[model samples]
Target: MSSTKDIDALIEMMAKLPGLGPRSARRAVLHMIKKRALLMIPLSDTLQNVAATARECLNCGNIGTSDVCDICTSHKRANGEICVVEDVADLWAMERSGVFKGRYHVLGGTLSALDAVGPEELRIPKLMTRIADEHITEVILALNATIDGQTTAHYIAGELETRGVAVTSLAQGVPIGGELDYLDDGTISAALKARKAL
Candidate 1:
């Protein structure tokens, strides 16, 4: 009986997206419906096209419309360094920062003992192979600050110990523009420990 059942279903589906809640999804759905010709149709077409063609890159584990993503195929990015990340989302975040010029290796997910995830489950084996095949000189770990993320980073560092490649991790400390009063004890300690000459 609800005449708006299909619209309700659409709102529910949109709510399942990362940051949108039910209220936001409803607003979005209504807005799209109001702008059906201007916004909804183009978005629907693009979504359909992307859903049909999106594929993970075989070389770097990045999602694209091809087997190998543009980053992996770009010669300018072959800087003998590979930034290792936990997921495609992490890889995308790093790319958006525009700081790292080298290629990347997405592990798919961090090693989780509780979840029964291991190196085999991730792309660790592929990473090791890439080190040798691509003549990689350095590997920068950009995992999250969570317990599982740190555990996975340590494990990867151990694995790369004998691989003749320099292994480093992203700096962990106070964030830029963060106030000292609002900072955690661990963060303050890390910032002090990593203090520079300036």
Candidate 2:
């Protein structure tokens, strides 16, 4: 009805993105419009290209522009070790750290009984196949700390145990900059339990 109708729609769509609220979306849209030539056009073209090409990797379920992601295809990644994560974001986070030099398996989500999600719904079967086909000897569970995450980790551990694969979990402890006074009781206990013997 108004001249700003298209701009309003754009703002609404951007607001639906994970971390962007209506106010932030409005600001972002306005900023983009001001830098239309430098930012908006490139962003629009890139979004379209990625939308057309992006797909989940056949091997590890990581989002990529091909059947298998680069990480899965890379010969340098340790073949015997696979990091099992709840989502692609977690995989990316681990990559950012540059610590684990191995392939990753994105489970899509945790096993949720309330939501009726199970191993069949996730990529657990695919993971088992990868382990056997790749001759994997170790699996590092990088799941979150939620109840459902723990349940899924335990279930996967049980499955891998029968296959004679060594299953490990990320050590839960105080963060690099976290203060003990600000941490929750569970974190304190986990950190204490995982303490080194130095």
Worst 10 residues of 2 by lDDT: 1-10
Tens digits of per-residue lDDT, candidate 1, 3-110, equal: 387998999999999999999998899899999999999999999999999999999899999999999999999999999998898998998999999999998988
Backbone clashes in candidate 1 total: 0
Compared with the true structure, the alpha-carbon lDDT of candidate 1 equals 0.93
lDDT of each: 0.93, 0.94
- In candidate 1, which residue ranges exceed 4 Å CA deviation? 1-3
Question: TM-scores of the models, in the given order?
Answer: 0.96, 0.96
Q: Tens digits of per-residue lDDT for model 2 on 69-171? A: 9999998895699999999999999999999999999999999889999998999999999999988999999999989899999999998888998999998
Count clashing residue pairs per candidate: 0, 0
Assess the local accuracy of residue 88 in candidate 2 as a C-alpha lDDT between 0 and 100: 90
Error of 1 at 171 (Å): 1.1
